[model samples]
Target: MNKALPVILICLLLFQCDSGKDGLPANSQLLRNTDISLSPDSFSPWVPVTNDGFSLGISQETFLSGNRSLFIENQDSLNVNAALWRQTYDGPMPSEGRRLTLRAHLKGENIELKSTGSNIYISVRMFPVEDSEGTTINRFLSSQNRFRIFGTFDWEPLAVSIPSFPKDVEFITVYLVMGPRTTGKVFFDDITLTVE
Candidate 1:
């Protein structure tokens, strides 16, 4: 029966929520096509990366979802270079001091790490919108080494978290790494980045 309460309720009812693309909430992220289910060869956002002896691509032969997953394969046990897939995102940036985390499903076959110094990690790099020389602001990069996977594993989850960024950050880069001393095939799917 309060007059002010009724006016406030009406104002709230008239306000429209921002429904993001694909009918997701404004804060909900579709998070690129990390699943590797989108178009390939010409327009896919995910890019394949490999050393001289490794091969990379979107494979339909193994996947956790959508019948497709990204793969990095090396047959030579002597090869010591890493094979990875990278995606650059210009999605929204988080506030100062907010944490960012990356999560993904990985399947490794015949995985072997020669050194404990290496890890099957997801690396992240956050770049500021602009760099003002002599300022404290700069790009941030990390591959949380504490999280590692090795020696043949089924479909398992992997996560890497990096510290917050300044207000100038505008885009982020992600990498799913396999090895510098491993011979195997690694599949990546359902990758996601969360800002908290």
Candidate 2:
């Protein structure tokens, strides 16, 4: 059936488009580079970059699900304040009273925390998308949640839930950060954020 061939192709294309390029289900909406094994450049848009201190790389020596995992090390040689990698979502915003949860598999090596502020944590910022481009924005209509991760440990489950938002926020940014006075290495895999 030559006529059925086109229908089959169309169905396949639609199915492929429903899921993410890295095989994430349609319900999972927080991460784009869930599995590092998909591609060397699978971590598109999200760069393993930092402002002042830290080193970022991918490693196969340790991982939770895939053949590769993201590894970050604080260079003790530098006066490090924060060493972090972040993923920002400029897409649709969750509605008010929506419950959001962040989860990840993490392992730390000789990790130390800061004495003053949050030493190591997942920082979540929800803000309004700018209506006008290139405008300096400086306000959070909703609360910010910092899921702190501390100490040295094996691959363990780390998760945090946001109760609900009082306002309609449009943009979300998640960061895997080691705050001031934090050092050593941290490995992360299977990081996810879900809205319910």
Candidate 3:
């Protein structure tokens, strides 16, 4: 009976195996709260707390999606100086020379730009974590490999891909940055990161 049990388990494991085109084990998910639900922690992975001296606001409102969508806005005493949000994933870095992709659905209204460098994007940030105690630092920033959104637009799909990264990298962070020094509202839903 024991000998037969081992064979049956092996067969089940083989039948259940699933992976992407890449030789590395597939990691299809990299973001949470994709549906933009009203759950208190829907944006937990993302820090909704305001930063610096800017009045950053994050709320749940019905618009896109079913129940609700993530709403990010900036409202200062005088004007919205800066408001930003992001989803970061930190784990074993991707393999060298592997395709990495980031995708999201976004809609904006009166997306004003207040500064020269202020811009919205779905970008990937790579940090190299040498060891358990090593401070994860930005190793490679995907400058051109990102989806940039601006101005007022309807719900649209945005996607970007990176051919590869260095082997030394040991961690990765995906960013959904709402341009700083900007006013108006931005809606987010269905965000995903995958390596293939």
Candidate 4:
């Protein structure tokens, strides 16, 4: 029996090592996920906001200087009042991946609750190639539903995690959205994605 124990221990250690490679605990209930921000500069190939109905700019001098900030111009009207920043990637993500945690620093000015709501928001989503405009492969986060509030030009780090899909997803897309129907300006910097 003592000899058998050694073999069993080796098997368990191997299993744990394999699981760790995918950034998951050995007994984790969720599927494996990886943080995208681990490689900061890899988030290239972004879509810039150009619709006349909306305005967009880089949120901060530091982020703008680093060339990593995305800003939305809020055009408040009875019918139309929102701005969006979006990007898509064609590479394969861990299909069995279950959740994404979006991390970023945010700031704002004249942040009226009525104009932009009481909070700032950010989100990440995954999409399949064949899906329609309204269809989403998976929703990692939504600012309207999940966000943090700050009223000054201070750097506040925020994070939100969503579990809607399994890890088997291929072709992922991410978006950072701010505002419900407000006109206040907000800044975002150091956007990151982590999977676990």
Candidate order (TM-score): 1, 2, 3, 4
For model 2, residues 1-196, the per-residue Cα lDDT tens digits are: 9999999999999888763332223354776776566686565545665656677878888888878888788756345466667777766555545667767778898876645453656656666534235332332221113445667789987776666633545667777666666677888888777766
**Which pairs clash (backbone N, Cα, C closer than 3 Å) in model 1?**
none
Number of backbone collisions per candidate, in order? 0, 0, 2, 13
Better of 3 and 4 by lDDT: 3
Residue-level lDDT tens digits of model 4 in 1-196: 9999999999999998887656442233221112222235453344554444556754335452354465665545331444566656545354354465666666666554454353457666654433454544554456655555545566667777655444444555556555554545666666656554
TM-score of each: 0.74, 0.69, 0.66, 0.60
Each prediction's Cα RMSD?
5.0, 9.2, 6.6, 6.8
lDDT of 1 by residue, 8-104 (tens): 8877766643222122222344268867777654427787777888888777789998769988877776777887888887755565556667889
Give each model's whole-structure lDDT.
0.70, 0.65, 0.61, 0.53
Deviating ranges (above 4 Å) for candidate 2: 1-28, 75-80, 129-150
Determine which window of 10 residues in candidate 4 has minimal summed lDDT: 29-38
Candidate numbers sorted by lDDT from highest down: 1, 2, 3, 4
What candidate 3 gets wrong by more than 4 Å, as runs, is 1-27, 38-42, 52-59, 75-81, 129-148
Cα RMSD of predicted structure 4: 6.8
Winner by TM-score between candidate 4 and candidate 2: 2
